[model samples]
Target chain A: MIDTAVLKQKLGDLDEDGVQALLDEFAAGTPSAEETQQVVEACQQGMEIVGENFEAGTYFVGDLMYAAQILTAALEQLKPLMSAGGGQAAKGTVVLGTVAGDIHDIGKNIFKALLEAAGFSVIDIGIDQAPSAFVETAKTNGAEIVALSGVLTLSIASMKETIEALAAAGLRDKVKVMIGGNAVSAETCEFIGADYWSKNAAAAVKQGLTYVS
Target chain B: MSEEKLKIREDLLAGRVPKRVFMQLRFTLEAACGLAGVDLVKAHFDPKTKLQAYRKVCETFYSDSFPIENVRWPEVYAPLGAKNWVMSSTGAMQHPEIESMLIEDYDEYIEDAFGTIMKKILPRIYPKLDPALPGAPLSFAKAYQRQQATGGEEVGAQIALSEEFDYAPGFFVGLFCEAPFDFLSDQLRGFRNITLDVRRIPEKVEAAVNASLPLMQRQAIPRNPIPGFTVFIPLHLAPYLRPADFERFYRPTFDKLIREINKAGMAAFLFAEEDWTRYADALAALPENQVIQFENGDVQKIKEVVGGKQIIGGFFDPLITLTRSKEACIDEVKRLLDIGMPGGKFFFAFNRHVLDIASIDVSKLVAVLDYVHEHAVY
Candidate 1:
């Protein structure tokens, strides 16, 4: 007999400790459908706190990384009990990676986390990924969206080549290709033939979901 | 005149020699001399020994010829070692053994070493250097201070140049403040936080901007001989930011910096390091004649916003250019030039530094440069 109102109140405050205690109470017994929704909502609240801290400069890469881990842990616990189809419906799948010759993954990882939280299935291909590898992964996973990540100025061309290869393979139209990284631009996106250009993780997730939907 | 010297001189005047070639030649020569067990100090005194070492390096690494032509070379620019030394010393000051040896205490020592090294090296390598060449003037502020300390008259700081050098000058400026937004999240926060902050904590953000403006304004001061442009690289506004955030957090700061830069009699080079497509209206509000070197923005949209007002540079992906074949390289360069190089004041290079790529194809890159020189119009 968990009080859903109290759980939602704790979640809204983004009290991680309070949310964790509420989660523990739910884990001890079967929580109703509304109670499970409260857990999901609590996770969202935690995300908001992380976002707030990040925006205010009190949080950093380490904090964002830890928040992602926290969300993942709580999500894993709630995944089984989540209404079989009641959880937000995923828009589509996106296969993302940092292009070859670039080993930066912080941006890509954050994008993946944001996407997952937004209820999109993400297959992160990691860094230093070849153009062919992106095409192969997209084809294998039936991913509707292919996202390329790059941080170095040098890797923009590689990202373009990947997009060109995707087009050459005649798979371009089937999948919406998005490019994000420090070095990419919309003109470069159009020049490279990518479908979308996003500056960071949150926008990438938003645009990715929109494209799939 | 020596054939090699004549060739290099011609290339420099034509701006055909890529900067990387000098770096590669220096690196290869150093390595070969080391491998041959040549004593650097001994060789410095003996012309014969130095020439012999050079010949060996040329023969083994740079082909068996006396001079290499149109070959791509590595660019090995020297960093501000004194700054690095200071930073490292400051980092180490936290330790028990060296806590007392603060960076300020080591300033004189660092200055002396830096000045001595510059004085010893500059005249030897760049005797006939021009101070007015773009990117030719190096910042040796520490070295100059050391010269002053060592009873050397103010002869002015020496400018190092070589016939084989190509210089592209750029800089990074902080876009926002450190008080309201932490530096780490400021670097990586997405647009969501950007938007929410404006709606929720506008006053705090404004205070941070106000506090940060003076520091950013100071960086706009141009101190070097060859007037290099100052480019402010902003990382705060990105995916998590929206048009409203830009208006609130970014616009006023930029307006202040632009005004300061203009007042200082310097050009403002704005390097937007994020996708600013959604906030084009805010970007367009920036002052005119300032160059906008976009890192990861929507190019067409950027062009629409600032194309007429500012000199736009970048958007080429350096990675593909490094790895692709010469044909592909030529095509990409030509295309970018057609779009980005149309208006005068438009300079081109890899959208960013080519940190990771196969070595730059010097010939291919040179070909693009030739095309741009021939075709670029205002």
Candidate 2:
């Protein structure tokens, strides 16, 4: 039996090789749905550790990035096994992208990984997406939330434009708007009429869960 | 050089002030030229027009507060098909397009790294350039040589311009060297891709950055010690890196680079681009007299940590400066001085400049700088 506590510890410690070694062991065994869910829960717990360490300055963005990679690899190994038996249902659907005129997607990608790990289906619209494209996608996909990310000051204006476009399409009230990036703040979120803003990836996923629950 | 300018330089080199606090005020050419009512597009292309406009702008705002001058260079505008700046509908000014990406695919980057960049990336960035055409490498070499020649001329011209107006010329070579990760992220792989690669294929990322260092050393490490000799290294991706990972990927090359610059008898102006507050303990261990210009970090905390050793250049918030009234701006300056100036190593500058021409209040900037110079003393 794989000691899941050890796996969680290695994942949080950002020991990529150790996590891989543990996952390999777990995969080689006749994995049941209960074991798979336990592994996924360990990954989430590991992410919480990564987030706490990040806040405490013991870890940095690169470390969070590495942690995300570990979780992604773990999921790839276990996702199929879980699907063959049973797995946690996705909590929500999020439509995410970097706002128009900004090509930076680091924060957005990190948030995507965290949200996915937290059991949310994400439709990433890619970078420099227009407001109309966002509105249309949200309307068509029946997305519960739209997350706009940008790292430039000019993106503040783009966020507002995206919100107005959603409102124009009569989809504003139907979907919550969340914003995250280096340039985003609570003040900017309020000004842009967004429902939420997070300074980091973990908080983004948590806030996203709150909207769904 | 004026006595005041010489004194400022001495104090800066010693990592301590003599008596009164020193201020290094900077301005974007866009802000200066806009103040002077010159068409930026026209001025950028014509050397005489550019200098004449700069001269007029300098005459208008040449004070103790306006000390540093970024010498104007005759820029060659991109052709119609590949223009990076688009003209406004009214034809009053040009706005820069979003920064274009150079590398389309990261999988091909290792191969492209070994291949001719002119054929691989340059043509994709600048549509006017053709990969099929011969002599691209020669043209690139000639352009580089021309830029070096013009850079020397620009320094001379700025010195004359400064003397003509009785302000010391603060001409320095902007030797931009990125940490290994940033070089890949900024130049070849986008941040998203590189972040993914950091976990998926860490060794490849290391190898790619290691391969690029030799070229960076040759290009970015200043060879000649001209007047106002300074190597301004703006560090990105450091704040984002874990300490061990940073030690592995960036610190070795960066330490060697600094040693090489110090051996050349040049001052290194290190710009801590993002929030490096977390790395204060490690950064404080570096050799002294380097000005680590903080763009977004706690002034008081950084002061307590690294203030004794290195020169702290800035902590004033640019957002406050841009949004606040003149009185509030001056108050902000006072607040910064209260926190940063007492130790005698602080210089007053905005965390960033108000690059939007219309948003720049020159009078407010002048007031804040003047207030710093008059009231901030050791």
Measured over all alpha carbons after superposition, the RMSD of each candidate to the real structure, in angstroms, is 14.1, 5.9
lDDT tens digits, residue span B1-378, model 1: 235434432332232432211111222223334444575444433435545554453433321112211111111112222211111110110001111112232233234423422443233233222234343445344344443432221111000111212211222221222212322124212233433334445665555455545545544454541233344444444434444554666666667766666566555555555455665565566565565556555666677667666656666554454456667876876776666543443445345433322324445655554554444433
A55, model 2: CA deviation in Å? 2.6
* lDDT (Cα, 0-100) at B27 in candidate 1: 24
Error of model 2, residue B345, in angstroms? 2.4
Minimal lDDT window, size 10, model 1 chain B? B89-98
TM for every model, in the order presented, reads 0.48, 0.75
TM-score of chain A, predicted model 1, versus the true chain A, to 2 decimals: 0.79
Query: Model 2, A1-213: lDDT tens per residue?
Result: 599889889988888889889888888997888888999988888888888887777777877777777788889988887876788877988999987766666778788888888889899999778999899889888999999997755467678889999999999999999998766666567767899987788877777888899
Residue-level lDDT tens digits of model 2 in B320-361: 444568898887777778888776777666565433345445
Considering summed lDDT, which 10 consecutive residues are worst modelled in model 2 chain B?
B89-98
* lDDT for each residue of candidate 1 in A1-213, tens digit (9 for 90 to 100): 466566555543444467678778887898665667666765665565566566564554434555565566678888777765367656688898988756666678777776786677888988778888999989998889998887655457678778888888878989998888766666567667788886645446657767766
Best by DockQ: 2
Q: Which stretches of candidate 2 lie over 4 Å from their true place?
A: A1-7, A21-42, A77-88, A160-175, A186-195, B1-10, B14-22, B25-135, B138-167, B170-172, B179-217, B321-329, B353-370
